[model samples]
Target: MSEIAVVAISIAKPGCEEQLRVALEGIVAPSRAERGALQYDLHRDLREPRRFVFYERWESEDALAAHGQSAHIGAYRKQIADWIEHSEIRVLKKIM
Candidate 1:
């Protein structure tokens, strides 16, 4: 199966940046250790401190799907639902 990549972005609500950051950071380690995870990195926007991004690579679509269904991810979504102002996620396939 071909590898897949994902880019996820989240913008925190005003006054919730630090709390959102801590919650997001808590998922990194466990996500990286999951099955079929090729890369899982978290980044913060320099100009917009409340914006955070997750750069991820997975073995396949199934792998990425599994990741989305993970316990941590569910907990994370519930935990940050109120703190996030906006969010986006994109799945990609390399062509070159």
Candidate 2:
């Protein structure tokens, strides 16, 4: 089966960029270590410093689901819930 990809975008609330960055950064290493993780990367928009994006690839839908249920992810979500102004997540499957 083809890999599953995820794109998550987050916009931080004013005055919360650094804290949001730290919380987002903290998830990378552990996510990369997950069994089905193919890629897990984070990016900050240069023109919009408070904007953050996550690019991730997982082995399967189940793997992606597991990631959503992960302890670290749960904690990260809870930690940033109040600090973010907006968030979006997309899950995709490659066509070619």
On lDDT, the candidate that comes out on top is: 1
Model 1 C-alpha lDDT per residue in residues 2-89, reported as the tens digit of each score: 9999999999999999999999999999999999999999999999999999999999999999999999999999999999999999
TM-scores for all candidates: the values are: 0.98, 0.96
Model 1 weakest lDDT span, ten residues long: 59-68
Worst 10 residues of 2 by lDDT: 1-10
lDDT of each: 0.97, 0.95
Count of clashing pairs, candidate 1: 0
Q: Mind sharing the TM-score for model 1?
A: 0.98
- Across residues 1-96, which tens digit of lDDT does each residue of candidate 2 receive? 568999999999999999999999999999999989999999999999999999999999888888889999999998999999999999999988
